[model samples]
Target: MLPELKDISNEEVKLPESSKVRLFIKREDRIHPFVSGNKYRKLKYNLIEAASLGFDTVLTFGGAYSNHIAAIASAGKLHHFKTIGVIRGDELRSKKDYNPTLKFAQAQGMKLHFISREVYKNKTAQTFLEELKRTFGSFYTVPEGGTNALAVKGCEEILKPEDSMFDYICCSVGTGGTLSGIINASKPHQHIFGFPALKGDFLSDIISKFAMKRNWELQTAYHFGGYAKINNELIEFMNRFKAENDIPLDPVYTGKMMFGIIDLIKKGYFPPQSNILAVHTGGLQGIEGMNLKLKKKNLPLII
Candidate 1:
C-alpha cells in the first residue's frame, strides 16, 4: 500500500506593502518526508503502473545531487521495488560519502551506476536506452526528472478548487512535466507562470506537448546562470527567506522561482491586488550537497 499523503496548506507570503500583490505558497513539501512536492506527485502513478505491470525493479536517471534520484530511492524502498540510478557523473562514484543526496539514496537501497558526462548526454537516445535495458534487465524506466505522462497526471492534482481565485499560478520548471500538469488543470482565467531553473527556450516547446491550455508563460530571466548554479545573492535570499518564513528552500529550484517571483512583483509584473500562488516543488534534500559546493567555492552557503 502507498503511504498516505498529508494535507497540504497554502502559506501566505508577507510581501512588501508597496508591491500591491498578494502571494501564497502551496506547501507541497509538507506532503512527504522523502517523496515531497513534485517528486511525490510524479512518482505516485508511476509506482502504481509499475506494480500493475509486474515490474520488480525501477530504473531512472539523475545527476550527483538530484532530488529525483533520492526520491526514487525512497519510493522504491517504501513500495518494495528494487531501484537503479544511472548517475550522470562518473567521478561521483568515489566521492559518494561527501555527497549527501547520493549517500542518502544509497542508504535507501538504490543501485548506483555512474556514467560519463558524454554518455549521460545520450540517456534518452533509443540506442543508449536499449543498452541500459540489456545491462539492467527488465525494469520500469522513470525517465530523467521523472516527467512521464503518468507523472503529469499525478501533478495535475496539486491545485485545489480554491486555487482558482489566484490570478497567477507559478512554479519552477525542470523537465516541464509539473508545470504542464498545472497548465492542464488550471482555470481559464488564471495565467500560469513558469520560472525555469535551466537556461533554455526548449522548455516552452517541451511543455506544449503535454499542456492542453495556452494560458502559461515561461519567465526565463532568473535561472541563476543555469541548472544547479548559485551565487551569493541567491544564497542570501534563501537564508533571509528561511529566517523570516521558517521555510527552507532548495537552491536548485524553489529558491530560484521565489527570487524571480519577488523580482517580478517589484517590477510591477502583476497588477495591483492580484493574487499569486507559487507551487513549492520541494528539493530541500539537495541543500546539504549544494552547501558542500558553495563551501568549496568559498561562497556564502545556503542556511
Candidate 2:
C-alpha cells in the first residue's frame, strides 16, 4: 500500500514586526522529497488516470532543473510506471551528471530525451506529438509543469473545510494548474493570489482556461526577473527567511512567494487584519542545481 498522506499543517510565519494581519505557510513541501508540494498535487490525478487508462509508460516535458520532471520520474518509479522526460535544451544532454535534478530523474529510471529549443517550442503540435508517439511508442502524456484538468482537480483538494477561516489564499503560479484548483475550491469570501515565477502576461489566459472564478489576482511584480532567474537579494532573503521562519524555501517558487507576501503586508496591500495563508509549494529539489550556478557566478546561494 502507498504511504498515507499526513494532515498538512499551516505554520505561522514569524514576521519581523507584528502587523495587523497574520501570515501562515501551508507546509506542502513536507509532502515528499521528490514528489513534493504543488508537483505532487499536479500529478496526483494524472498518474491515477494513466493507470486507469491502462498506460504503463508516461511522458512529460520540462527544462533541466524542473521540479515536475524530477517528481514525475520519482512517482512513476514508485508506482511501477515507466517515465520518459523530454528535456529542453539539447545542450544539457551531456551535463546530466552535473545537473542534480536530471541525475536524480535518471536514477529514478526515467529515460531522458533531449530536444532542441526550436522543437520543444512546438511540443504540443499534433505532428510533433505524433512523432513522439512513433519514437517512444504509446504513452500517457502529461504536459510541462503538469497543468491539466486532472491536475487542477487534484489541486482543488489543497484547501480544506478548516481553511475557510483565512480571508486570503496565496500560491506560486507556474503553469497555473495549482492556482486554478485553489480558485475553484476557495470560499466565495476568500481572495486568491498568484505569484508567477515566470515573467509573462500570457499566464492570465492560461489561468482563465482552467479557473472557474474571478476571485483571484496575479501578483506579477515579484518574479525577480523570469523563470529560473535569481539575484543576490533573492538569495539573501531566502537565507534570512529560513533563519527566521525555520522554513526552507525553493528559490524559484516558494521563496519568491514568501518575499511577495511580506512585501505586500508591509505595503498594506491586503485589508487590515486579514488572515493570509500562503501555500509553500515545494521545489526544494532544484536548490542543489541552482547552487551550482550560483557558485560559478560568485553569488550567495539559497539557504
Candidate 3:
C-alpha cells in the first residue's frame, strides 16, 4: 500500500492590514520523519516502479548533504531495497573526516560512491549512466533529487483541491520537479506560485522549458544568498515562524522560500483577500551541518 497522508489542517498566518493576505501553510513537513514532504512525492512512484521491474537496488546522485540521499536511504531500508548514493565532491581533507549526512546514510546501509566534481557534472550523460550501470552491478538509477517525470507525476498530488477554502498554492523550488508537478495538477482557476531558492539567471527558463504546458507562474527573487547559503534574517525568520506556528523550516531551503513568499505578499504581490497555500518541502536534516557552519561563522543566533 502507498504511504498514508498524515496531517490535514489549515494553520492560518495573519498578515498586516496593509498586506491584506491570509496565508495557510500545508504542513507536508510532518508527512514522515525521514521521507517528508516533496521527498515523499518524488520517491513514491519511483520506488514502486523499481519494485515492479524486479530491481533489488536503487542508485541516485546528490551533494555531500542531500535530502534526496537521506530519503532514498530511509525508503530503501523500509522497503527492503538496497540503496547506493553517488555523492559529489571529495571527502574533506582539513577538518575531521566526517559529514553527518554521509554518516547517517552509511548507518542506513547506503553504500557511498564519492566522485570528483568534474566526473559528477557528467552524471546526466548517457555514457556516464551506462558506466554506473556496469559499476554498480544491476540497479534502478534515479536522477539527482529524483527530479524526473515520475517524480513530477507524484508531486502532482500536492495540488489536489483542499476541503477547506483556499485560492493559491506556493512552495520552494529546488530542482523544479515539485513545482512542475503541482502546476501540472492545479486547477486553471487556482493561482500557483513557486519561490525559487536559486539565482534567477536561467532557472526560470529551465523550469519553464521543462514545464512546457505553461500553466503556472514561477518567481525567483527570494533566493536570498542562493542555494545552500543562509543569512541572519532568514535564520531569525525560521526560528520565529516555528515559534509562532510550530512549523520548522530549514534555512537552506524552505525557510528562505517562505520568507520570500511572505515578503512578496506584504509588498502587494497578492490581493489582501486572497487565500494562499505554502508547501513545506522537508529538508530538516540538511540543516544539521549548515547550522554548525553558521554557528562557527559567529552569526547571531535567533534563539
Mind sharing the TM-score for model 2?
A: 0.98
Identify the superior model by TM-score, candidate 2 or candidate 3.
2
Badly placed stretches (over 4 Å) of model 2 are 1-4
Question: Which pairs clash inside model 2?
Answer: none
Off by over 4 Å in 3: 92-97, 209-213, 301-303
Q: List the residue pairs that clash in candidate 1.
A: none
Candidate 2, residues 1-303: lDDT per residue as tens digits? 125578999999997566889999999999998898888888888888998999999999999999999999999989999999999999999898889999999999999999999999999999999999999999999999999999999899899899999999999999999999999999999999999999988999999999999999999999999998899889999999999889999989998998899999999888888999999899999999999999999998777
Model 1 CA deviation exceeding 4 Å by range: none
Over the stretch 120-150, how does candidate 1's per-residue lDDT look in tens digits?
9999898988898899899999999999899
Please give, for residues 1-303, the per-residue lDDT of candidate 3 as tens digits.
247785555567756666677888777777788888899999999999998999999999988788999889988988899999998886532322367777778788898888889899999999998898888889998999888888888887775556235677888888889988877777656777888777765656656755646656767777886888778878888888888877778776788878988888867878768888888888888777776677789986544
How does each model score on lDDT?
0.93, 0.93, 0.80
Q: In lDDT terms, how accurate is model 2?
A: 0.93
Steric clashes per prediction:
0, 0, 1
Model 3 scores worst on lDDT over the 10 consecutive residues at 90-99
Give TM-scores for every candidate, taking all chains together and pairing residue i with residue i: 0.98, 0.98, 0.93
